[model samples]
Target: MSEQNQDKHQQRQQKVKQKVDERIAAAQKEQGIFQVITGNGKGKSTSGFGTVARAVGHGMKAAVCQFIKGTWECGERNLLEKAGVEFVIMNTGFTWETQNKESDTVAAQVTWQEAKRMLKDESINLVMLDEITYMITYGYIDLDDVLEAVSSRPAMQSVIITGRGAHRKLTDLADTVSEVRNVKHAFDAGIKAQKGFDY
Candidate 1:
């Protein structure tokens, strides 16, 4: 009975390997990818930072623009800036903290101007637009303007956009889209955000 089970497992493995090999062989093209990470889960921004780390490992230049999060020091911002990544932290804090619509709109516009420059720069290999979805969702910035700038960027420059409630158009334009579903969270259980783990 054991011998029979082993033979069946080997056969299944061989079939799976063949299918995987075929897919690998078919995928021969490479180009800059637009990636979107969004959802209620905690890892949206973290996932974007992972790509920044990947770009750094490859010695590729990267630019990161933080839209609605500033005011306080962020671990990724400090590390990436120290590692020579072009980093911009734009607001005084989240929207709720600022409590000013007009001012927040202005800040969003200014931050996007810098982001647009980074996107267009051919020398930059990757650009991470952190928490940009909120700006779009709240009508702080024009979606068309953002789309125009992004679509006109260098052909080989990758872009990673992370936040909750991503724009539908942005998701459609992205080559890769991932939604981090929340099954459980430490914050929900009354645990505070931990250093180096939550940040």
Candidate 2:
């Protein structure tokens, strides 16, 4: 074949393969169930909140159980609440910020109990467990319990678990996993977190 004809043949082959892959992926998307967003970088909870907005936009019920860093005002929470999203704030903030392990543990337990309820509720189409990895890392909640709750959730229900240091077991069980890596952050340059951006 001539050079131009060969090139055209390869391009046509690539297009066919791309279409096949797209169809395969669509076929595999049986029912959205579990997702894990984790990393040292920011935006985990932000991504989860985005999913909450999407779910609520589609007229689906959604809930958020904030496991840590709940003392500060969250713009997403305000907007989501107004949109009819249920929220359960642990209200203990970060462990380092609180400087009390017992208090953090107590708050995590309370939040975990509520999370369990939400996970089991078939009425809720989307559930966001914001900053839950910290509770798992600190042993504030049982890993097995979390695994079981996620496993038993309704097949059509979607869950977003977000935080840093997500457990390997959780990632293994997630239908989709995304880790946001920090390349450059303004906080590294001594810029304090700005409202509506960080908080």
Candidate 3:
């Protein structure tokens, strides 16, 4: 081949390689393994549920294990269940709301165990651990266990951990972390938590 033609060929190959590199970088940015939604505000679970919806929309399998606030009828649970999202509710109301620490702790532990199983399932593309911070804060489950699961899930699997008072360690392990700050809520304005809106 002529030297000039050889140079042109090399340039074309370089351009193609650059394009491939760019595409791979974009794909990696879109893929993530760990996420946390936390703060004193509401919508932590709602944010997690939104991810669940997105995952389900893409036909990805998902699992949700809600720790506290499980007994109440949740609209997300109802809708997602019908859509083939596996859900395991702890069935223990809020510890403060229930005024039963022991029972709540036991329930949280049980739910965490189930979540751990779901996290290890290679078939599950996404796992949402709703209200998981309470389990860590109350010592119902070891923070190390949570960290290990977040770190060791399938390379492409994503996990969403949601609750207020998220520990610093959890945040450190998260690839994406968001805090939902509550500026104001209708409940503070004498509006009850409506069935569909709040519950």
Candidate 4:
């Protein structure tokens, strides 16, 4: 490249670096962040689990409350359980499949009790509520209870909520919200949910 072009490139990069430095310097607070991963696409729970794994990798205490799950084995749970991450499963599977609102409500409430305990426990560094939005949607769990527990959680405890069509209140309270759009999915093409990949 010509010296003039190279000089211009250097100047542009220098300005970019300055902006980045300023932004970095401006962010000085250290506190746990609430993250919401929701949308019509897959991978919401996967993303939440990934964050739990990241916390475990850093030797942080983490707990996961899996709503609307059955007895099926989870790959992430298998690994994280061994890593000392506490797990509370609703064990009700899909609400449509269960077709028993009374029993499902009971199960949801029981699982939510465990989640509330984890949220109040200051020792736990992170809590992942997997597919919890469905419970709220079905009225199986109280939305106010969830909001209160999360909002009152330990200041250093981070929470991750993942599901489709998350409540507006949750999105508003979250520090980071990510929406996964469904452009295409293998299930629509008659592809079965593979073990490790889907679970």
Q: Rate the local accuracy (lDDT) of all candidates.
A: 0.90, 0.91, 0.89, 0.93
lDDT of 3 by residue, 127-188 (tens): 99999898899888999989998888888889999999999999998988999998999989
**Candidate 4 local distance difference test against the native:** 0.93
**lDDT tens digits by residue: candidate 4, 82-190:** 9999999988788888899999999999998999999999999999999999999989888888899999999989999999989999999999999999999999999
lDDT at residue 165 of model 1 (Cα atoms): 96
lDDT of candidate model 1 versus the reference? 0.90
Ranking by lDDT: 4, 2, 1, 3
Query: What's the TM for model 3?
Result: 0.84
Model 2 residue runs over 4 Å out of place are: 1-29
- Model 2, 1-199: lDDT tens per residue? 9999999999999999999999898886567579999998878889989989999999999999998878999999989999999999999877888888888888899999999999889899999999898899998899999999999888888999999999999999998999999989999999999989997
State how far residue 121 of model 1 sits from its true place (Å): 0.7
Predictions ranked by TM-score, top down? 4, 1, 2, 3
Between prediction 2 and prediction 3, the one with superior lDDT is 2
User: TM-score winner among the candidates?
Assistant: 4
Write model 1 residue lDDT over 1-199, tens digit each, in one string.
5999999999999999999999999988888889999999989998999899989989999999999767766888879888999887785689998899999989998898899989989999999999999999989889998888788889999999999999999999899999999999999999998878877
Residue pairs with colliding backbones in model 2 are none
Per-residue lDDT, model 2, residue 14, is: 99
Q: How much does candidate 1 score in TM-score?
A: 0.94
